[model samples]
Target chain A: MRNLTEEELRVVFEKLAKFIGKDIKALVEDSNENYCFRLQKDRVYYAREVVAAAATNIARHNLASLGICVGKFTHGGRFQVHITFVTYLARLAKYKVWLKPQSEMSFLYGNNVLKGGVARMTENTPKNQQVVVFNQSEIPLGFGVSARSSLEVQQASSTDLIVLNQADVGSYLRDEDHFVGCGL
Target chain B: MDGVEVDLGSLSCADVRPIFQEETKQELEERIRRSVEFLVHGLFTLPEQSSERKSQRELPEPFSVIPRAKPIPKEKPLTKWEQFAKIRGIRKRKRDKFAWDEGRAEFRPIHGYRSINDGSNQVILPHDPSLEPGESPFDLLKEGKRKRIASNRKNQERNKRSLSKNQLPTHALRADKRSSKSLERSAKIVSISNRSLGKHEEGKKSKQKLSSTKRSLKKSIIPNGVERERTFQAVNDVLKNF
Candidate 1:
């Protein structure tokens, strides 16, 4: 894929900075044949992704931050961008939401990781339907997009990265609250 | 109805009639007499010898009181060991106080030096080598080493005290002996009061911090599309807008 235009790169970094609170140090076109953007900051690879360049122009705009991986090397390409992004999205969707008050909500997390928070499509789309939206702002802050084919029992197989369906989502919440066997 | 007279053969009528009348009267009297005699004999005659029954009925006599012998009391047997142990335990308890004081002192001396020396010396040195008739050269050498160590420790402790002359006696010695006797009781009251004050202060601080945080979280919204910094950025954005 051709390199991202200077203007396009700037706009993407701006969106990223607004969401992440950190400026993009560098942006480079990835060596992979698929069109992916490699975001560099302070000489460290922070995030890299396949820009979904074709999807960007199609107007089916859902900016999906699939997953995050700590860089194993200084050079950006050590990890695959699209796979990592998908993993990150699945991880975010796996976060369970506690129905308790915020004071008790602290139990859902360790080291300030937001563990219990519910995420649903803006329009409550049916199971297996794809949700696309422009920019991350359209999506809830604590919630993220699902890249897999179907979210099953709140569990997406590693091979099949589906968004977790609603019943499974409720089941996860019930299990997390230690009320699994309460016939939820 | 005719007055024709019937006469016996060759008998006159008057004589035959009178004689017939008298004989008839006599015959009737004899029959009546015989019936009377049969009735009187039945009345006088009773039961025959075979019909009579033998007498066997009897009645009980008055009752009398009888005395019984008094029962004897039996002795409860005692085991030899139980009696001996009871007597031994009483005597041992009386003797134990002094032994326990000596044992505890040997077991745990307050000064580390003494405790270590006491333990090591007991293992290495003879209990009372002098009791043996022959005195070994090693025994004298060991005794000399122990004496030197004891003197050196005593001198070092004195030097340490002199160096820290300005330091107050530890809290332990400052309390009077009588007060120290009830140290745990007084310490309990002091600790309880301190803990209560500490808990109250902590509660107040947490409540104040929570209210301020809740207000801030409610007002803030992350400015950009980034997910990571939203919480902190939102707070900052709210503060900036406010």
Candidate 2:
């Protein structure tokens, strides 16, 4: 609800650059609370929340980017660090690993990936590297960390204990999963 | 044993048996008696009348291939208002079983009594693979191997030309730079050879300058984490203005 000044904007931008790992070309604030932070004219992140103090700390600490989080207007009442879909996509575009439909379902359900489900992975992907998980159509489904390097995944029969899932778009589609269906 | 009658000739055997065994009186009586019994049995067994046969004979023969009968005449039960409504309803009613909703860009009546399950809508389409970190399908790789088993003679000739160009000494490259045509020819030559030109040629060469120009023109081609490291140094340069 609060507006950020020029000085605060600079701090936010610096934090975003650290988080996004790219130079933010421009930052445009809309009439509403929604903020469009441009990476380029075409590529932009619509940040829903911005807190100058938190952003300053994020930049100072060099914390790994959590994309856009619901920023606290006041200092440290409660921080809602949410990974926005745009950031999800950015991660997916770069650090990607493909999952079979079955693996995709499992990953969406917040289960860790097992061996042999990865249809493809980025070359030179070292073991334990963070990866974006994608479905067969190549849509970025979520994010995870790889259990094995790309070469090991290929050479080794099982990527057992591979790709531990962090977040997935399936969360939006599924309920709390209070009751499971028999796929009836 | 005391009264055994051995002499049957003298005994009255003719009197014991019938005096006239083939007599006409006996034959006529036997024949008359058989005739009377037969007449009585025939009269009782025979049917009195054939009423079914007479009725069947009286009726006309049915047609072997009968034509379908005409429906009975009837008047329309609907009123004028009702008939008009019925005709008006036909336009929409005549529509295909599925009605498309342009607003949603999907079929209307999605939730229906008849339509129990819509798994297609339920299924999530994966993001386009091109959007992911991958080599473009259109990207012509430095392909050493042939796609097909059969060798292309034309390709081989192009390859040979490229090989001959590569054999040319590094200093010889400058001689071809004056004419744009040679540089264009070199690009074609390089592509066919399926190998990277030396690092010196990459810097000094003028052929396929578009490839280099594009590389320069594209500021942010790669997205995501890779972009982070590549652009990290540049970030400070850009941020210095602030």
Candidate 3:
């Protein structure tokens, strides 16, 4: 579980940063696992993917600050990749702009009521509602560059990602419909 | 008309009389059988139509529609099963008419009627719980996190669909007057983004500076100090110098 040399990790980060720069501010590879990279941003994104490889090809997984192992499934195949990331920024954006405001409309219909369990945070939400708050829960949406491609190194080809942020997502959502379910 | 001439010489009464009498007897028997069938099958019935026919014949000439009502044409008396069916049919038709009238009355447009969800004139904030009428449905909706999110998404989708309908090229929805301006504004913003990212490069470069200034202005407007520290410093410094 020795860390990859600074050079090796830098190459991977640079390659990945180019694809999802809007969502990922930076990423780090720690010395706790082989072939594992920690993706960093305002909030850690939950990385979920469908990956297929031979028993000898890969070893472990990690996402920035989250030590919890995300769920995984395997099929008898040589190559596959299905991934999902639940970012705190994304969750926060959803709560503030989409979910929290909806509570005011709860008395009207059966479907609008908020089941009491998961804590929520948002502006304009009433004081009585009791929401767990976070100061760094924001995602930059419209103001970023995004790209996905394969980068061929000397021995193996890895999928490269890059993202760049330029605009405030809050304003963009204001002009557009703010209430979207799931990750848009 | 001289009561239609009868050629008795060519037609023998011997053969004809027996045939007529036999037919009359058969018809009388059948009529009696039907009367018995109606009584035995069920009490409700058309009482002896033959008697009704006889009474009609006895009425003053002016009161009769047919002078010779073609003697009911020897119909076989209703079988017991048929008698029951006829009575049931009459009752069913009467019941149907009554039910139909009752149902139709409910749907009729009353002079000043209003519906609970009337979208007729303007946006009615759904009966607010804050109002005295009842705890608003919105409150029920607010109780569950999952339900609340689902409802908001549904509402947004409905609004989007309605907006699209209103902005249709030729036929706009007259009912969406309140939302038309806001929808148009947002539609323009969407068009700006969707404008093929490839068009008019020279314009984009010239407009780039304008956009950056707008971005800076937006950053300066953010209330959080951490977000706009540099802009706040510049503003404060200018204010202090003044």
Candidate 4:
């Protein structure tokens, strides 16, 4: 694992801020332990400083994964957050959407959440904002880009798309091969 | 007259007298007059050419009598290749300026403009067995030619640098002065503030200078909370503009 370059760091931070907003500071400056981001084979890992340092002893090709895999930088240099990053984002997400029980399975099946599927959403959530998706019991399922803001969602037709699904917990099984060294 | 001898080539006459002979000033002047008269008579008797205007006596070619004004210059020092050639007893042979090119079926200049081997005119290059699978011969040839041009340019730059180091210290100092420290610092700041921090800029020489300035500005592992605070501020700045 290596330290992210200034350019890569800015991209990662900006993408993270889109979902968590100002809480990126809390993510970096955790009170209990020091956490830092390390990059290995284009995948950015969030790990304790000691763990990141110790993992350096392993050869690059042999080492599959280290700490929690947050995201991977695409070949085009865009940062793409993975489904595994849901835990952290769910905790600090500024806006959230809760899916009704009947439509949760459809969302897990990689389909966009329609207006009728959304049980509730954070008030005043802006349009096209990144938001975490949760069930009625507050169990984080996935994350998506909001197609309509809270105000617009009230007026939107039932069949109209409310949230555009980006990544979901169902990817754990569907994309199992991709997450081989992603520390599960 | 019997003791005098004359060299027509030098226009000079030498008179020989006995060592014990004493002569008065009038006798000396009379002897010189007789010698001069004899010389002029001999000149008139030799030959004559008549032109429309006048008749003139033809004179024989004169022997050079005067010494040269300056000494002969020393030969220049031999170059390395010349010295080597001399040691090996190699004699240079002149080659013809033009060579027959079989492909063109005509004689062409061996070097310079429109040379036979310039490759620019080739529409189809022979396929090479060593080329990788799926690789186009045309693209490979182009890449190789580009690499050769780049290397040639690099070698030329190296030669120029060596030449400047050996012969143009004042010129090199003037170049340094032209890119003064304050000017360079301002340029660096401008480059850093430009879109993409001037990372996509073209100039190879100035790129090195810009990177050095960037390295100096980069913070080296600041204390944990301080860096977090700095990142927080940067995030705020981005969010404020967002």
Winner by DockQ: 4
Worst 10 residues of 1 chain B by lDDT: B8-17
Please give, for residues B1-242, the per-residue lDDT of candidate 3 as tens digits: 12222222232111121224446777766655554454333322223336645432222123223367566565444544456779788443322211222423444333223422222433334555455665655444445545655666655544544544233332323324436455554443443443554244444332322122223323322222332233233333433433
- Residue B121 shift from truth in candidate 3, angstroms: 99
Each candidate: fraction of true contacts kept?
0.00, 0.03, 0.00, 0.03
**For residues A1-184, what per-residue lDDT tens digits would candidate 4 score against the true structure?**
5667666777888999999987877887655988877788899998887787678667778889888999999999999999998999999999999999999999998999999999999999999999999999999999999999999999999999999999999989888999998977
- Chain A vs native chain A, TM-score per candidate: 0.23, 0.54, 0.21, 0.98
Q: Residue A109: error of model 1 in Å?
A: 20
B33 Cα displacement, candidate 3 (Å): 99
lDDT against the true structure, per candidate, is: 0.33, 0.46, 0.30, 0.77
Tell me, by lDDT, which candidate is best. Answer: 4
lDDT of 3 by residue, A1-184 (tens): 1122233333333323233322223222222322232222222122211111121122222322332111122233111111122232333221232223333223112122222211232333322221221222233222122221112111222222121222233432443432221124
Compose the digit string of candidate 1's lDDT tens values, residues B1-242. 02223222222122111224446777866655554554344333523344345432222232323344766655433334445777777443332222222644554443445543444445355457455567754566668778987777655443343333222233523233323224433343333345443345443232222112223321222222232233234334433433
Query: How far off is residue A179 in model 4, in Å?
Result: 1.5
- Model 1 chain A TM-score equals 0.23
DockQ of each: 0.01, 0.02, 0.01, 0.05
lDDT accuracy of residue B228 in candidate 1: 27
What order do you get sorting by DockQ, best first?
A: 4, 2, 1, 3
TM-score for each model: 0.18, 0.29, 0.13, 0.49
Better of 1 and 3 by lDDT: 1
TM-score of chain B of each: 0.18, 0.13, 0.16, 0.32
Can you write out model 4's per-residue Cα lDDT over B53-119, one digit (the tens) per residue?
5556667776646587999975544545567899999999998889999987999999756887777
